[model samples]
Target: MRTPADFCADKDALLVPAVRIVVRIVGVEQQKQGDAHVLGATEPELKCGPGVDNDGYFDADTPLGPYYLAPDAAIRLLTYDEKAQRMGLTDPVPVATLRDVLKACKSGKQPGTPYTCSGGFFHAAMDTKGVITELTEIFQS
Candidate 1:
């Protein structure tokens, strides 16, 4: 498996502070080209610190960026049980593949769904169109 650091190794990669938050999904809208899903939230409330179980923290004051998922973005779903091993709680297992996650996010619009999104290190790259070309989630395990 490629470590999170590997994703951001590119010279042009930008490191952004990821914050853990519980969001009551207000709405989920799909892009016309079927390339992304825009998640609408009622102001995400901080669930824990920036890291897993509040073990580590990032810039708490950093504002939450755009709430959306790129179709090709790397999605890692770390379960509570899977994180019990040496990999740590932040180490996520790929339950729903990236494609499935994107599909779910697009079609599954469960308003008021309480979702816990942990903050991790996100290595992102922006394209000339101001769109995210790559996004990798790196949780501190």
Candidate 2:
């Protein structure tokens, strides 16, 4: 079984195991693989906001990895309904939210707010191949 530490540059380096991480979507790049195209994660060009001290969070300006979304990954947009005391309402409107978020980020315009950059941020679990297996939208509290 591969772990998050495998994503590190050094193979023998000791690192903590991480199953999930919050990441800022800067943009996406499509590359042709065989007969199909695959989208890879992209990072921002400049540092333009205050830094957070979260361990597994990757800001847009961090320029972290060549992470890719798995072909069969589960992607969902979640919103908390205050009255319902629940999050991740099964709404169809936010179904394509992730794509829109990436599109806005790729446009090169600053997001209206720091946390809501291009709508919202995401927390995902990546496999050893640097492929995101699960991606879920998260809102700032």
TM-score for each candidate, following the candidate numbering: 0.37, 0.48
For candidate 1, write residues 1-141 as lDDT tens digits.
223333234323333333222222333366778657664433322232334453333333434444665565444332233344432222332323433443454465421212222333343444544444444433433
Using lDDT, give the best candidate's number.
Answer: 2
lDDT of each: 0.38, 0.46
As a whole number from 0 to 100, the lDDT of residue 3 in candidate 1 is 34
Each candidate's clash count: 0, 0
Could you report the Cα RMSD, in angstroms, for every candidate shown?
Answer: 9.2, 8.9
Angstrom error at residue 66, model 1 = 2.4
Per-residue error for 123 in candidate 1, Å, reads 2.3
Tell me how far the alpha carbon of residue 99 in candidate 1 is from the true structure, in angstroms, after superposition: 11
The TM-score obtained by model 2 is: 0.48
